[model samples]
Target: MEEIEETPEEHLAKQHRKEKKDMQAKIQSMKNAIPKNDKKRRKQMTEEIAKIEADLNNKHEEELSQLKSSTDTKVEEVLNGVETMKMEGGKEAEAEAAEEEEEEEEEEEATQPRVTKAQKRRDKKATQEKERESRIAEAEVLNLQGVRHQEGLKLAQKLATKQLQIKEISSDGHCMYRAIEDQLAQRTKPEITMSMKELRSRTAEFMRGHADDFLPFLTNSNTGDMYTTDEFEKYCSDVEHTAAWGGQLELRALTQVLLLPMEVIQADSPPIKIGEEFDSEPVTLIYMRHAYGLGEHYNSVEQLKDPANAEDS
Candidate 1:
Protein backbone atom coordinates (compact mmCIF):
# COMPACT_ATOMS: atom_id res chain seq x y z
CA MET A 1 0.00 0.00 0.00
CA GLU A 2 2.94 2.33 0.63
CA GLU A 3 4.53 1.87 -2.78
CA ILE A 4 3.71 0.33 -6.12
CA GLU A 5 5.97 -2.50 -7.23
CA GLU A 6 6.22 -4.25 -10.57
CA THR A 7 3.88 -7.23 -10.58
CA PRO A 8 4.60 -10.50 -12.38
CA GLU A 9 2.51 -9.39 -15.34
CA GLU A 10 4.54 -6.19 -15.61
CA HIS A 11 7.82 -8.12 -15.35
CA LEU A 12 6.70 -10.29 -18.26
CA ALA A 13 5.91 -7.17 -20.26
CA LYS A 14 9.26 -5.60 -19.48
CA GLN A 15 11.03 -8.76 -20.67
CA HIS A 16 9.04 -8.94 -23.91
CA ARG A 17 9.51 -5.26 -24.74
CA LYS A 18 13.26 -5.65 -24.36
CA GLU A 19 13.26 -8.77 -26.53
CA LYS A 20 11.16 -7.15 -29.26
CA LYS A 21 13.43 -4.11 -29.44
CA ASP A 22 16.63 -6.14 -29.47
CA MET A 23 15.44 -8.39 -32.29
CA GLN A 24 14.17 -5.54 -34.43
CA ALA A 25 17.28 -3.45 -33.87
CA LYS A 26 19.50 -6.41 -34.69
CA ILE A 27 17.72 -7.07 -37.99
CA GLN A 28 17.70 -3.38 -38.91
CA SER A 29 21.42 -3.14 -38.24
CA MET A 30 22.13 -6.14 -40.45
CA LYS A 31 19.97 -4.70 -43.21
CA ASN A 32 21.74 -1.33 -42.97
CA ALA A 33 25.22 -2.89 -43.12
CA ILE A 34 24.59 -4.73 -46.41
CA PRO A 35 25.97 -3.03 -49.52
CA LYS A 36 23.35 -1.66 -51.94
CA ASN A 37 24.62 -3.81 -54.82
CA ASP A 38 24.21 -7.00 -52.73
CA LYS A 39 20.64 -7.63 -53.82
CA LYS A 40 20.83 -11.20 -52.59
CA ARG A 41 21.82 -10.21 -49.05
CA ARG A 42 19.26 -7.46 -49.07
CA LYS A 43 16.56 -9.99 -49.93
CA GLN A 44 17.83 -12.23 -47.14
CA MET A 45 17.72 -9.34 -44.71
CA THR A 46 14.15 -8.59 -45.75
CA GLU A 47 13.16 -12.20 -45.22
CA GLU A 48 14.77 -12.37 -41.81
CA ILE A 49 13.02 -9.20 -40.77
CA ALA A 50 9.67 -10.61 -41.78
CA LYS A 51 10.33 -13.89 -40.03
CA ILE A 52 11.24 -12.26 -36.72
CA GLU A 53 8.37 -9.82 -36.94
CA ALA A 54 5.85 -12.60 -37.14
CA ASP A 55 7.58 -14.70 -34.50
CA LEU A 56 8.07 -11.93 -31.94
CA ASN A 57 4.64 -10.49 -32.42
CA ASN A 58 2.97 -13.85 -32.01
CA LYS A 59 5.07 -14.73 -28.99
CA HIS A 60 4.36 -11.47 -27.21
CA GLU A 61 0.66 -11.62 -28.03
CA GLU A 62 0.26 -15.14 -26.76
CA GLU A 63 2.14 -14.43 -23.54
CA LEU A 64 0.12 -11.32 -22.81
CA SER A 65 -3.11 -13.07 -23.69
CA GLN A 66 -2.36 -15.79 -21.21
CA LEU A 67 -1.40 -13.34 -18.49
CA LYS A 68 -4.46 -11.19 -19.11
CA SER A 69 -6.78 -14.16 -18.95
CA SER A 70 -5.23 -15.23 -15.67
CA THR A 71 -5.95 -11.82 -14.22
CA ASP A 72 -9.33 -11.21 -15.83
CA THR A 73 -11.14 -14.32 -14.56
CA LYS A 74 -11.34 -12.60 -11.19
CA VAL A 75 -13.78 -9.72 -10.87
CA GLU A 76 -11.00 -7.72 -9.22
CA GLU A 77 -9.06 -7.41 -12.51
CA VAL A 78 -8.39 -4.06 -14.19
CA LEU A 79 -11.06 -3.89 -16.88
CA ASN A 80 -13.84 -4.90 -14.49
CA GLY A 81 -12.42 -3.39 -11.33
CA VAL A 82 -15.21 -0.88 -11.07
CA GLU A 83 -16.47 -1.89 -7.64
CA THR A 84 -16.06 0.78 -4.98
CA MET A 85 -14.38 0.45 -1.60
CA LYS A 86 -17.66 1.43 0.08
CA MET A 87 -19.36 -1.53 -1.54
CA GLU A 88 -16.66 -3.87 -0.26
CA GLY A 89 -17.00 -2.48 3.23
CA GLY A 90 -20.77 -2.90 2.99
CA LYS A 91 -20.35 -6.57 2.10
CA GLU A 92 -18.26 -7.13 5.23
CA ALA A 93 -20.86 -5.36 7.35
CA GLU A 94 -23.61 -7.49 5.83
CA ALA A 95 -21.71 -10.68 6.56
CA GLU A 96 -21.14 -9.60 10.16
CA ALA A 97 -24.82 -8.74 10.60
CA ALA A 98 -25.82 -12.20 9.38
CA GLU A 99 -23.64 -13.92 12.00
CA GLU A 100 -24.42 -11.81 15.05
CA GLU A 101 -27.10 -9.63 16.64
CA GLU A 102 -26.55 -5.90 16.04
CA GLU A 103 -25.52 -5.45 19.71
CA GLU A 104 -23.11 -8.43 19.53
CA GLU A 105 -21.55 -7.12 16.30
CA GLU A 106 -21.05 -3.78 18.03
CA GLU A 107 -19.43 -5.54 20.96
CA GLU A 108 -17.12 -7.44 18.64
CA GLU A 109 -16.36 -4.21 16.84
CA ALA A 110 -15.34 -2.66 20.14
CA THR A 111 -13.01 -5.52 21.14
CA GLN A 112 -12.07 -7.70 18.15
CA PRO A 113 -9.28 -6.64 15.80
CA ARG A 114 -10.63 -8.64 12.84
CA VAL A 115 -14.00 -6.86 12.74
CA THR A 116 -12.66 -3.35 13.33
CA LYS A 117 -13.24 -0.51 10.84
CA ALA A 118 -9.50 0.21 10.74
CA GLN A 119 -8.78 -3.35 9.59
CA LYS A 120 -11.59 -3.14 7.02
CA ARG A 121 -10.27 0.14 5.64
CA ARG A 122 -6.78 -1.29 5.34
CA ASP A 123 -8.14 -4.29 3.48
CA LYS A 124 -10.09 -2.03 1.15
CA LYS A 125 -7.01 0.03 0.33
CA ALA A 126 -5.03 -3.12 -0.37
CA THR A 127 -7.68 -4.32 -2.82
CA GLN A 128 -7.81 -0.89 -4.42
CA GLU A 129 -4.06 -0.91 -4.96
CA LYS A 130 -4.21 -4.35 -6.54
CA GLU A 131 -6.87 -3.18 -8.91
CA ARG A 132 -4.78 -0.14 -9.79
CA GLU A 133 -1.82 -2.38 -10.57
CA SER A 134 -4.01 -4.60 -12.73
CA ARG A 135 -5.09 -1.53 -14.68
CA ILE A 136 -1.48 -0.64 -15.31
CA ALA A 137 -0.74 -4.20 -16.44
CA GLU A 138 -3.70 -4.16 -18.83
CA ALA A 139 -2.42 -1.02 -20.55
CA GLU A 140 1.08 -2.44 -20.86
CA VAL A 141 -0.18 -5.69 -22.37
CA LEU A 142 -2.25 -3.80 -24.90
CA ASN A 143 0.63 -1.53 -25.83
CA LEU A 144 3.29 -4.24 -26.09
CA GLN A 145 1.33 -7.24 -27.37
CA GLY A 146 -2.13 -6.66 -28.94
CA VAL A 147 -0.80 -4.15 -31.48
CA ARG A 148 2.90 -4.96 -31.73
CA HIS A 149 3.43 -5.70 -35.43
CA GLN A 150 1.17 -3.03 -36.89
CA GLU A 151 3.13 -0.25 -35.16
CA GLY A 152 6.01 -0.34 -37.60
CA LEU A 153 3.77 -0.10 -40.70
CA LYS A 154 1.74 2.71 -39.15
CA LEU A 155 4.98 4.53 -38.33
CA ALA A 156 6.34 3.91 -41.82
CA GLN A 157 3.14 5.18 -43.40
CA LYS A 158 3.28 8.32 -41.30
CA LEU A 159 6.94 8.81 -42.15
CA ALA A 160 6.43 8.17 -45.88
CA THR A 161 3.51 10.58 -45.95
CA LYS A 162 5.74 13.12 -44.22
CA GLN A 163 8.74 12.24 -46.45
CA LEU A 164 10.71 10.97 -43.49
CA GLN A 165 12.31 7.57 -42.89
CA ILE A 166 13.89 5.94 -39.90
CA LYS A 167 17.56 6.18 -39.12
CA GLU A 168 17.56 3.10 -36.91
CA ILE A 169 19.21 3.19 -33.50
CA SER A 170 20.13 0.10 -31.49
CA SER A 171 17.42 -1.34 -29.19
CA ASP A 172 19.72 -1.35 -26.19
CA GLY A 173 18.63 0.61 -23.10
CA HIS A 174 20.73 3.55 -24.30
CA CYS A 175 18.35 4.10 -27.25
CA MET A 176 17.35 7.66 -26.32
CA TYR A 177 21.01 8.65 -26.04
CA ARG A 178 21.92 6.97 -29.35
CA ALA A 179 18.96 8.56 -31.12
CA ILE A 180 20.22 11.98 -29.99
CA GLU A 181 23.70 11.08 -31.20
CA ASP A 182 22.39 10.20 -34.66
CA GLN A 183 20.36 13.41 -34.82
CA LEU A 184 23.38 15.48 -33.82
CA ALA A 185 25.51 13.97 -36.60
CA GLN A 186 23.00 15.17 -39.18
CA ARG A 187 22.59 18.67 -37.72
CA THR A 188 26.27 19.50 -37.05
CA LYS A 189 27.70 17.83 -40.18
CA PRO A 190 31.49 17.39 -40.25
CA GLU A 191 31.50 17.86 -36.48
CA ILE A 192 32.13 14.59 -34.65
CA THR A 193 29.06 12.93 -33.15
CA MET A 194 29.07 12.68 -29.40
CA SER A 195 29.19 9.16 -27.88
CA MET A 196 26.04 7.96 -26.14
CA LYS A 197 28.05 7.53 -22.95
CA GLU A 198 29.21 11.13 -23.05
CA LEU A 199 25.67 12.34 -23.71
CA ARG A 200 24.31 10.30 -20.80
CA SER A 201 27.04 11.56 -18.49
CA ARG A 202 26.37 15.14 -19.45
CA THR A 203 22.65 14.78 -18.93
CA ALA A 204 23.18 13.15 -15.55
CA GLU A 205 25.61 15.88 -14.50
CA PHE A 206 23.15 18.55 -15.61
CA MET A 207 20.35 16.92 -13.65
CA ARG A 208 22.46 16.76 -10.50
CA GLY A 209 23.50 20.40 -10.69
CA HIS A 210 19.97 21.63 -11.40
CA ALA A 211 18.08 19.35 -9.04
CA ASP A 212 15.37 21.88 -8.36
CA ASP A 213 14.20 21.83 -11.95
CA PHE A 214 13.57 18.05 -12.21
CA LEU A 215 13.10 16.65 -8.68
CA PRO A 216 9.60 18.01 -8.21
CA PHE A 217 8.41 15.99 -11.18
CA LEU A 218 9.95 12.71 -10.07
CA THR A 219 8.66 10.50 -7.25
CA ASN A 220 9.88 7.25 -5.72
CA SER A 221 7.79 4.55 -7.32
CA ASN A 222 8.31 2.25 -4.36
CA THR A 223 7.46 4.67 -1.56
CA GLY A 224 5.10 7.08 -3.31
CA ASP A 225 7.19 9.95 -2.00
CA MET A 226 9.02 12.81 -3.65
CA TYR A 227 12.65 11.87 -4.16
CA THR A 228 14.91 12.99 -1.35
CA THR A 229 18.31 14.47 -2.10
CA ASP A 230 20.05 11.11 -1.57
CA GLU A 231 17.59 9.25 -3.78
CA PHE A 232 17.95 11.86 -6.50
CA GLU A 233 21.71 11.38 -6.38
CA LYS A 234 21.25 7.65 -6.76
CA TYR A 235 19.00 8.27 -9.74
CA CYS A 236 21.58 10.59 -11.28
CA SER A 237 24.29 8.01 -10.68
CA ASP A 238 22.21 5.35 -12.41
CA VAL A 239 21.55 7.66 -15.34
CA GLU A 240 25.28 8.23 -15.73
CA HIS A 241 26.55 4.72 -14.93
CA THR A 242 23.71 2.29 -15.58
CA ALA A 243 21.65 1.17 -18.58
CA ALA A 244 18.58 2.82 -17.05
CA TRP A 245 15.94 3.80 -19.58
CA GLY A 246 15.79 7.51 -20.32
CA GLY A 247 12.56 9.45 -20.88
CA GLN A 248 11.54 13.10 -21.07
CA LEU A 249 13.47 13.81 -17.87
CA GLU A 250 16.77 12.97 -19.49
CA LEU A 251 15.51 14.57 -22.69
CA ARG A 252 14.98 17.78 -20.76
CA ALA A 253 18.47 17.59 -19.34
CA LEU A 254 19.93 16.81 -22.77
CA THR A 255 18.16 19.78 -24.34
CA GLN A 256 19.66 22.05 -21.68
CA VAL A 257 23.19 20.54 -21.73
CA LEU A 258 23.38 20.46 -25.54
CA LEU A 259 21.38 23.69 -26.00
CA LEU A 260 19.17 22.35 -28.80
CA PRO A 261 15.56 21.55 -29.53
CA MET A 262 14.46 17.94 -30.08
CA GLU A 263 11.31 16.61 -31.68
CA VAL A 264 9.79 13.26 -30.66
CA ILE A 265 7.73 11.87 -33.53
CA GLN A 266 5.30 9.14 -32.61
CA ALA A 267 3.41 6.83 -34.94
CA ASP A 268 -0.05 7.66 -33.66
CA SER A 269 0.37 11.14 -32.17
CA PRO A 270 1.65 14.47 -33.37
CA PRO A 271 5.34 14.99 -32.74
CA ILE A 272 6.14 15.70 -29.04
CA LYS A 273 7.92 18.99 -29.64
CA ILE A 274 10.49 19.80 -26.88
CA GLY A 275 12.70 22.81 -26.12
CA GLU A 276 10.86 25.72 -27.71
CA GLU A 277 13.07 28.53 -26.40
CA PHE A 278 15.97 27.79 -28.76
CA ASP A 279 16.05 28.86 -32.41
CA SER A 280 18.05 25.79 -33.53
CA GLU A 281 16.61 23.15 -35.83
CA PRO A 282 15.14 20.42 -33.70
CA VAL A 283 16.87 17.03 -33.81
CA THR A 284 14.09 14.57 -34.60
CA LEU A 285 13.49 11.07 -33.22
CA ILE A 286 10.53 8.72 -33.68
CA TYR A 287 8.80 7.24 -30.62
CA MET A 288 7.17 3.83 -30.99
CA ARG A 289 4.43 2.47 -28.72
CA HIS A 290 3.29 -0.94 -29.91
CA ALA A 291 5.85 -1.67 -32.63
CA TYR A 292 9.27 -2.38 -31.24
CA GLY A 293 9.86 -5.50 -29.09
CA LEU A 294 11.34 -3.05 -26.72
CA GLY A 295 7.62 -2.17 -26.15
CA GLU A 296 8.66 1.46 -26.60
CA HIS A 297 11.46 2.53 -28.95
CA TYR A 298 13.11 5.61 -30.43
CA ASN A 299 14.90 6.05 -33.76
CA SER A 300 16.46 9.00 -35.57
CA VAL A 301 14.54 10.68 -38.40
CA GLU A 302 15.87 11.46 -41.90
CA GLN A 303 14.59 12.41 -45.33
CA LEU A 304 13.13 9.34 -47.00
CA LYS A 305 15.41 9.90 -49.95
CA ASP A 306 18.26 12.36 -50.41
CA PRO A 307 17.33 14.79 -53.21
CA ALA A 308 20.97 15.70 -53.98
CA ASN A 309 21.86 12.05 -54.64
CA ALA A 310 18.45 11.00 -55.96
CA GLU A 311 19.71 8.88 -58.86
CA ASP A 312 22.74 7.31 -57.10
CA SER A 313 20.86 4.42 -55.49
Candidate 2:
Protein backbone atom coordinates (compact mmCIF):
# COMPACT_ATOMS: atom_id res chain seq x y z
CA MET A 1 0.00 0.00 0.00
CA GLU A 2 1.25 3.48 -0.90
CA GLU A 3 1.89 5.82 2.13
CA ILE A 4 -0.28 8.97 1.88
CA GLU A 5 1.59 12.30 2.38
CA GLU A 6 0.32 14.22 5.48
CA THR A 7 -1.37 17.68 5.12
CA PRO A 8 0.41 20.80 6.52
CA GLU A 9 -1.95 20.91 9.50
CA GLU A 10 -1.50 17.19 10.22
CA HIS A 11 2.31 17.58 9.96
CA LEU A 12 2.23 20.53 12.42
CA ALA A 13 0.15 18.52 14.90
CA LYS A 14 2.56 15.59 14.59
CA GLN A 15 5.51 17.87 15.23
CA HIS A 16 3.85 19.38 18.32
CA ARG A 17 3.12 15.92 19.79
CA LYS A 18 6.78 14.85 19.29
CA GLU A 19 8.03 18.06 20.87
CA LYS A 20 5.73 17.63 23.88
CA LYS A 21 6.90 14.00 24.36
CA ASP A 22 10.57 15.14 24.21
CA MET A 23 9.85 17.83 26.84
CA GLN A 24 8.24 15.24 29.12
CA ALA A 25 11.26 12.96 28.76
CA LYS A 26 13.62 15.83 29.62
CA ILE A 27 11.53 16.64 32.70
CA GLN A 28 11.70 12.98 33.83
CA SER A 29 15.50 12.95 33.36
CA MET A 30 15.89 16.15 35.38
CA LYS A 31 13.75 14.74 38.19
CA ASN A 32 15.82 11.52 38.25
CA ALA A 33 19.14 13.41 38.30
CA ILE A 34 18.14 15.39 41.41
CA PRO A 35 18.95 13.65 44.68
CA LYS A 36 16.02 12.85 46.98
CA ASN A 37 17.79 14.52 49.90
CA ASP A 38 18.33 17.74 47.86
CA LYS A 39 15.17 19.63 48.72
CA LYS A 40 16.26 22.89 47.10
CA ARG A 41 17.11 21.34 43.75
CA ARG A 42 13.98 19.20 43.84
CA LYS A 43 11.84 22.26 44.41
CA GLN A 44 13.46 24.06 41.48
CA MET A 45 13.00 21.05 39.21
CA THR A 46 9.33 20.80 40.23
CA GLU A 47 8.69 24.41 39.21
CA GLU A 48 10.47 23.97 35.88
CA ILE A 49 8.53 20.81 35.10
CA ALA A 50 5.29 22.55 36.00
CA LYS A 51 6.05 25.34 33.52
CA ILE A 52 6.89 22.89 30.73
CA GLU A 53 3.74 20.87 31.40
CA ALA A 54 1.67 24.07 31.29
CA ASP A 55 3.19 24.98 27.92
CA LEU A 56 2.41 21.51 26.59
CA ASN A 57 -1.21 21.81 27.79
CA ASN A 58 -1.54 25.24 26.18
CA LYS A 59 -0.13 23.96 22.90
CA HIS A 60 -2.56 21.04 22.92
CA GLU A 61 -5.51 23.38 23.55
CA GLU A 62 -4.42 25.73 20.77
CA GLU A 63 -4.10 22.86 18.26
CA LEU A 64 -7.55 21.55 19.22
CA SER A 65 -9.08 25.00 18.96
CA GLN A 66 -7.58 25.54 15.48
CA LEU A 67 -8.77 22.13 14.29
CA LYS A 68 -12.35 22.81 15.54
CA SER A 69 -12.43 26.28 14.00
CA SER A 70 -11.13 25.18 10.57
CA THR A 71 -12.97 21.86 10.11
CA ASP A 72 -16.62 21.13 9.04
CA THR A 73 -19.27 19.79 11.50
CA LYS A 74 -18.55 16.05 10.83
CA VAL A 75 -14.75 16.58 10.97
CA GLU A 76 -15.10 18.62 14.22
CA GLU A 77 -17.08 15.72 15.82
CA VAL A 78 -14.33 13.28 14.75
CA LEU A 79 -11.59 15.63 16.12
CA ASN A 80 -13.46 15.92 19.46
CA GLY A 81 -13.53 12.08 19.84
CA VAL A 82 -9.78 11.93 19.02
CA GLU A 83 -9.10 14.67 21.61
CA THR A 84 -10.90 12.68 24.34
CA MET A 85 -8.85 9.54 23.57
CA LYS A 86 -5.64 11.63 23.51
CA MET A 87 -6.48 13.05 26.94
CA GLU A 88 -7.07 9.59 28.38
CA GLY A 89 -3.80 8.32 26.86
CA GLY A 90 -1.94 11.33 28.24
CA LYS A 91 -3.25 10.67 31.77
CA GLU A 92 -2.25 6.98 31.66
CA ALA A 93 1.20 7.85 30.32
CA GLU A 94 1.68 10.38 33.12
CA ALA A 95 0.71 7.77 35.75
CA GLU A 96 3.17 5.25 34.28
CA ALA A 97 5.90 7.91 34.07
CA ALA A 98 5.43 8.79 37.73
CA GLU A 99 5.74 5.15 38.82
CA GLU A 100 8.91 4.68 36.75
CA GLU A 101 10.49 7.79 38.25
CA GLU A 102 9.81 6.61 41.81
CA GLU A 103 11.34 3.20 41.09
CA GLU A 104 14.43 4.81 39.59
CA GLU A 105 14.86 6.97 42.69
CA GLU A 106 14.61 3.96 44.99
CA GLU A 107 17.17 2.00 42.99
CA GLU A 108 19.58 4.94 42.94
CA GLU A 109 19.29 5.43 46.71
CA ALA A 110 19.92 1.76 47.41
CA THR A 111 23.15 1.86 45.41
CA GLN A 112 24.53 4.95 47.14
CA PRO A 113 26.70 4.81 50.26
CA ARG A 114 24.59 5.04 53.41
CA VAL A 115 25.53 6.40 56.83
CA THR A 116 23.76 4.57 59.64
CA LYS A 117 22.21 6.51 62.54
CA ALA A 118 24.61 4.76 64.93
CA GLN A 119 27.63 5.80 62.80
CA LYS A 120 26.45 9.42 62.70
CA ARG A 121 26.06 9.48 66.47
CA ARG A 122 29.55 8.04 66.92
CA ASP A 123 31.05 10.67 64.60
CA LYS A 124 29.31 13.51 66.48
CA LYS A 125 30.52 12.18 69.83
CA ALA A 126 34.11 11.89 68.57
CA THR A 127 34.07 15.49 67.30
CA GLN A 128 32.77 16.76 70.68
CA GLU A 129 35.44 14.81 72.57
CA LYS A 130 38.20 16.26 70.36
CA GLU A 131 36.90 19.81 70.97
CA ARG A 132 36.79 19.20 74.73
CA GLU A 133 40.38 17.90 74.73
CA SER A 134 41.57 20.91 72.69
CA ARG A 135 39.94 23.33 75.21
CA ILE A 136 41.56 21.51 78.16
CA ALA A 137 45.03 21.67 76.51
CA GLU A 138 44.58 25.41 75.90
CA ALA A 139 43.57 25.97 79.54
CA GLU A 140 46.64 24.07 80.75
CA VAL A 141 48.95 26.14 78.53
CA LEU A 142 47.28 29.35 79.75
CA ASN A 143 48.34 28.58 83.36
CA LEU A 144 52.07 28.84 82.45
CA GLN A 145 52.59 32.58 82.02
CA GLY A 146 56.26 33.52 81.33
CA VAL A 147 57.85 30.48 82.93
CA ARG A 148 58.18 27.01 81.46
CA HIS A 149 55.39 24.57 82.29
CA GLN A 150 57.57 22.84 84.91
CA GLU A 151 58.75 26.17 86.38
CA GLY A 152 55.15 27.37 86.57
CA LEU A 153 54.24 24.23 88.48
CA LYS A 154 57.10 24.95 90.91
CA LEU A 155 56.02 28.60 91.31
CA ALA A 156 52.47 27.50 91.93
CA GLN A 157 53.82 25.13 94.60
CA LYS A 158 55.85 27.91 96.21
CA LEU A 159 52.85 30.26 96.19
CA ALA A 160 50.82 27.40 97.60
CA THR A 161 52.41 28.19 100.98
CA LYS A 162 50.93 31.71 100.77
CA GLN A 163 47.64 29.92 100.02
CA LEU A 164 47.13 31.94 96.84
CA GLN A 165 44.60 30.84 94.23
CA ILE A 166 44.08 32.81 91.01
CA LYS A 167 40.47 33.25 89.98
CA GLU A 168 40.16 34.16 86.31
CA ILE A 169 37.74 36.83 85.06
CA SER A 170 36.45 37.51 81.56
CA SER A 171 38.83 39.70 79.52
CA ASP A 172 35.96 41.59 77.91
CA GLY A 173 37.49 45.03 78.68
CA HIS A 174 35.51 44.90 81.92
CA CYS A 175 37.90 42.57 83.75
CA MET A 176 38.72 45.17 86.41
CA TYR A 177 35.09 45.80 87.17
CA ARG A 178 34.32 42.06 87.21
CA ALA A 179 37.34 41.39 89.45
CA ILE A 180 36.28 44.16 91.85
CA GLU A 181 32.73 42.85 91.82
CA ASP A 182 33.97 39.35 92.63
CA GLN A 183 36.11 40.59 95.52
CA LEU A 184 33.37 42.83 96.92
CA ALA A 185 30.90 39.92 96.78
CA GLN A 186 33.30 37.88 98.88
CA ARG A 187 34.15 40.49 101.58
CA THR A 188 31.00 42.57 101.92
CA LYS A 189 27.61 41.56 103.24
CA PRO A 190 25.34 39.89 100.64
CA GLU A 191 23.05 42.91 100.58
CA ILE A 192 26.00 45.30 99.99
CA THR A 193 27.59 43.40 97.12
CA MET A 194 28.26 45.77 94.19
CA SER A 195 27.62 44.68 90.59
CA MET A 196 30.09 45.54 87.81
CA LYS A 197 27.60 47.95 86.18
CA GLU A 198 27.10 49.82 89.42
CA LEU A 199 30.87 49.94 89.96
CA ARG A 200 31.45 51.40 86.45
CA SER A 201 28.82 54.15 86.98
CA ARG A 202 30.20 55.03 90.42
CA THR A 203 33.81 55.13 89.17
CA ALA A 204 32.91 57.41 86.24
CA GLU A 205 31.02 59.75 88.57
CA PHE A 206 33.89 59.94 91.07
CA MET A 207 36.51 60.62 88.36
CA ARG A 208 34.35 63.37 86.80
CA GLY A 209 33.71 64.97 90.18
CA HIS A 210 37.39 64.87 91.22
CA ALA A 211 38.80 65.88 87.84
CA ASP A 212 41.51 68.09 89.39
CA ASP A 213 43.02 65.26 91.45
CA PHE A 214 43.02 62.68 88.58
CA LEU A 215 43.60 64.86 85.49
CA PRO A 216 47.33 65.30 86.15
CA PHE A 217 47.91 61.54 86.40
CA LEU A 218 45.56 60.74 83.52
CA THR A 219 48.04 62.08 80.93
CA ASN A 220 48.79 59.99 77.86
CA SER A 221 51.32 57.33 78.87
CA ASN A 222 53.46 57.84 75.74
CA THR A 223 52.95 61.58 74.96
CA GLY A 224 52.78 62.73 78.60
CA ASP A 225 50.17 65.23 77.27
CA MET A 226 47.20 65.93 79.54
CA TYR A 227 43.76 65.05 78.19
CA THR A 228 41.78 68.03 76.82
CA THR A 229 38.36 68.75 78.31
CA ASP A 230 36.59 67.06 75.38
CA GLU A 231 38.93 64.07 75.55
CA PHE A 232 38.36 63.74 79.30
CA GLU A 233 34.60 63.88 78.83
CA LYS A 234 34.73 61.17 76.13
CA TYR A 235 36.91 59.04 78.43
CA CYS A 236 34.34 59.40 81.20
CA SER A 237 31.61 58.43 78.76
CA ASP A 238 33.49 55.30 77.63
CA VAL A 239 34.11 54.23 81.20
CA GLU A 240 30.46 54.64 82.10
CA HIS A 241 28.80 53.08 79.01
CA THR A 242 31.39 51.33 76.84
CA ALA A 243 33.45 48.26 77.65
CA ALA A 244 36.72 50.25 77.77
CA TRP A 245 39.70 48.31 79.12
CA GLY A 246 40.59 49.43 82.59
CA GLY A 247 44.08 50.73 83.46
CA GLN A 248 45.91 52.03 86.55
CA LEU A 249 44.17 55.39 86.17
CA GLU A 250 40.76 53.70 86.34
CA LEU A 251 42.03 51.64 89.29
CA ARG A 252 42.90 54.84 91.16
CA ALA A 253 39.43 56.20 90.45
CA LEU A 254 37.88 52.96 91.64
CA THR A 255 39.89 53.11 94.89
CA GLN A 256 38.52 56.60 95.66
CA VAL A 257 34.99 55.56 94.76
CA LEU A 258 35.05 52.38 96.87
CA LEU A 259 37.28 53.95 99.59
CA LEU A 260 39.09 50.62 99.95
CA PRO A 261 42.76 49.79 99.67
CA MET A 262 43.61 47.87 96.47
CA GLU A 263 46.80 45.81 96.17
CA VAL A 264 48.29 44.22 93.07
CA ILE A 265 50.72 41.29 93.40
CA GLN A 266 53.19 40.27 90.70
CA ALA A 267 55.87 37.67 90.45
CA ASP A 268 59.40 38.78 91.64
CA SER A 269 57.93 42.17 92.62
CA PRO A 270 56.73 43.71 95.87
CA PRO A 271 52.98 44.22 96.29
CA ILE A 272 51.79 47.58 94.96
CA LYS A 273 49.10 49.24 97.04
CA ILE A 274 46.59 51.95 96.04
CA GLY A 275 44.24 54.01 98.29
CA GLU A 276 46.34 53.36 101.37
CA GLU A 277 45.40 56.79 102.76
CA PHE A 278 41.71 55.91 102.47
CA ASP A 279 42.06 52.66 104.40
CA SER A 280 44.94 51.06 106.29
CA GLU A 281 43.47 47.57 105.83
CA PRO A 282 43.91 45.86 102.45
CA VAL A 283 40.71 44.70 100.76
CA THR A 284 41.94 42.37 97.98
CA LEU A 285 45.02 41.29 96.02
CA ILE A 286 44.73 41.18 92.23
CA TYR A 287 47.29 39.28 90.12
CA MET A 288 48.44 41.23 87.04
CA ARG A 289 50.79 39.91 84.32
CA HIS A 290 51.10 39.19 80.59
CA ALA A 291 49.39 35.94 79.63
CA TYR A 292 50.79 34.35 76.45
CA GLY A 293 50.53 37.58 74.42
CA LEU A 294 46.98 38.06 75.75
CA GLY A 295 48.09 41.45 77.11
CA GLU A 296 47.27 41.70 80.81
CA HIS A 297 44.61 39.85 82.79
CA TYR A 298 43.63 40.72 86.37
CA ASN A 299 42.47 37.88 88.58
CA SER A 300 41.41 38.16 92.21
CA VAL A 301 43.37 36.11 94.75
CA GLU A 302 41.77 33.76 97.24
CA GLN A 303 43.83 32.38 100.12
CA LEU A 304 43.27 28.85 101.29
CA LYS A 305 44.88 26.75 104.05
CA ASP A 306 48.16 25.19 102.89
CA PRO A 307 47.41 21.63 101.81
CA ALA A 308 50.62 20.28 103.38
CA ASN A 309 49.99 22.11 106.71
CA ALA A 310 46.40 21.00 106.70
CA GLU A 311 47.52 17.40 106.17
CA ASP A 312 50.08 17.70 108.97
CA SER A 313 47.52 19.14 111.40
lDDT of 2 by residue, 1-313 (tens): 1224557577677668667766865665465444343357678778988998998889888987887677667687899997987788897787898899999999999997888999778877776676558656875777556453443344355456667666668655577789888888777343346888998899899899988877887654346689778767777887889776676778888887777888876654666789889744455555555432323556665665466763343
Query: What are the per-residue Cα lDDT tens digits for candidate 1 across 50-94?
Result: 988999999999999988888777646544444554466687776
Name the regions of candidate 2 deviating beyond 4 angstroms: 1-159, 188-191, 220-224, 278-281, 309-313
Q: Which whole-number lDDT from 0 to 100 does residue 223 have in model 2?
A: 61
Q: lDDT of model 1 at residue 154?
A: 70
User: Which pairs of residues clash in candidate 1, taking residues 3 or more apart in a chain or in different chains?
Assistant: 17-293, 17-294, 20-293, 21-293, 21-294
Candidate 1, residue 27: Cα displacement in angstroms equals 18
- Count of backbone clashes, every candidate in sequence: 5, 0
Residue 23 of model 1 has an lDDT of 84
Off by over 4 Å in 1: 1-146, 188-192, 306-313
Q: Relative to the true structure, how large is the alpha-carbon lDDT of every model? A: 0.76, 0.69
Which run of 10 residues does model 2 get worst, by summed lDDT? 286-295
